[model samples]
Target: MIQNIVLGQIKRDPRSVAMANAYGTIADGYFAVGYNPAMLAYQQDKPFMLQLFGIDMGIGGNFISLQNLNSLSGDTIYAAGENPKNPHDDSKDRLFRQFDDAGGLAFRQDFHLPMPIINYSSGNMAFTSNLVWMSNLVFPIGILELLFYGNGRRPNMDMTFNVEVFGVNELGFTFAVPYDRFALGATVKYLQGLFYFGVDPDSSRANLVTSDYHLYGSGKYLFRFG
Candidate 1:
């Protein structure tokens, strides 16, 4: 497992997200702060721009969808030694098949709220701030297999899961200097980490093995905070 923190503007602008980041070249005003600060110099006519209130939110996953949720909502998963409500139901098998050999399911959610009265642009300079929150989760295929099918088919199981949640306030000052045929720009950013909570995937490990007579497994989880 690999874990790292990457700091930058990711899907912060609704227009950019809608355009699939194709707005980089024509980005202007407050939107140019991260996409391309040099584009700010092109906003000669728009002397002032202020963003009072705006919000950008996104949620996505590999195995999560409305149809999938509706299909599995009524299905019940029973514990070991417990009688299942529907013994012949294929819901469990269907759910297990959703995961591939690489992994079970991965999910991510992010929210970007531009601080009111702080996002402004004047001429070739801009000051912007945003409150950002993000979270991620992963369910390993081995764990899912063990849960649904037990360790009878696969004697050995690799159980590795990951989770991360963090929030930060990004404050930036962007400026541009235009020349005859070119422009130079820069954005100074101060990332104030509000909080961080995650499981250290590299250090966390878990495994299970089953034999004819006994089953054994061990797990260790390392959590991080800031």
Candidate 2:
């Protein structure tokens, strides 16, 4: 579904995810040139960096990230997406904002866990893997409530739609070799499983109709770099 596409985009892209510090993995930066940790160690000359983030639609602003980078064996490193929310704003109702029949919005004031990615070298060969997670899901209560009450207040029509399951997770792997003054690599991605969802159409709840989500695919390519 398109919802999945949007979710995947926000997850894979640094510009969109806010807390994503790793480059190359997205489009820019060199970290993504290969999936191997050994390749990253090559660039350890750069000191660790931390990013402070915040977001708010209009009234108030909320902080969301505290990340750090350091060196490790084979040039592998890890980053945690964590921060704390104030004492006041701590409820699901307050954690998220509902825009009409749209989905719920939550401010990930604190990251669930540290997203880890690693790269390593063995002789002329290198390898890398990325395991990251973020929360951008907006679950609208209005939609779920409608599932129970046919017409919570106004009801006249109904709607329903369905599509095939394509994938649930995205996995990327890279294989590379070191050459004179440079490293080269190629990646293969495997998108496994599929999930589908559709809502019924109803005029009163046109906002909660099946035609709401914007669907797209979650696929990418990997290339070599030094």
Candidate 3:
């Protein structure tokens, strides 16, 4: 048995992302709600801060990139006919070689939208609200090989994949109390689950086997939603 898990959260501020999350100690105002709320105490001189509108989004993948897309855009990786146009082309082989044996190719995306009129900060207390959405997908290398090279060379293949998506609305109240040498701060958050969808790995199975005289395969996928 083999299992893998990937976990991540989207950065809510561009400055945090640009600084590679090193801005936590210095974060102030409404931005400190998610990082170090204690830092909010240092913003006493700013009077008040209001966030009218803001959006953060990101998308990327291990096996997909601008360079790879440009290189494989017009190339035909596979054809069903007996005589194909590019019979000597190695594009299919090149694509198959990109994956390793350890794990599948993965892609992820996330979006964050701060509520406009509700996000505000004053004195040592602040209130904020946001909507967040996240998605992830994985394609097994075995499935890619089967798609690119067919069953002629590899008689057996595994067709397992993973996918997940979820969304949530968060409302938080933050407060900070400053002392002579330190500060105490905390954030109270209310989370409302908007939706969730994913494949049940424990209940899903798929495989394929081919031979000269016969071909056999089985597939069962269980999806869950909330």
Rank by lDDT (best first): 1, 3, 2
Worst 10 residues of 2 by lDDT: 54-63
For each candidate, give its TM-score against the true structure: 0.68, 0.28, 0.70
Candidate 2 lDDT by residue in tens digits, 1-226: 1122222222223353464434333332223333232353343433332212222111111222232112222432111222143433323232223222233222321121112433332333333332322223333344434443434332322222211112234454444555678766565555543343323222113223322344222222232121
Candidate 1, residue 129: the lDDT equals 89
Alpha carbon RMSD to native, model 3? 7.0
- Clashing residue pairs, candidate 3? none
Estimate, for each residue in 115-204, the C-alpha lDDT of model 1 and write its tens digit: 999999999999988898889888877777777777777788877788999998998888999999989988888889999999998899
lDDT of 3 by residue, 68-158 (tens): 8887888656433433675666655655666654356888887778888788888788898889887888886667767677779888887
Candidate 2 versus the native: TM-score? 0.28
Best candidate, TM-score: 3
lDDT of each: 0.78, 0.31, 0.75
Better of 1 and 3 by TM-score: 3
Candidate 3 — which residues are off by over 4 angstroms?
A: 1-11, 60-103, 144-153, 210-217
Candidate 1 Cα outliers beyond 4 Å, as residue runs: 1-7, 10-14, 60-104, 144-151, 207-218
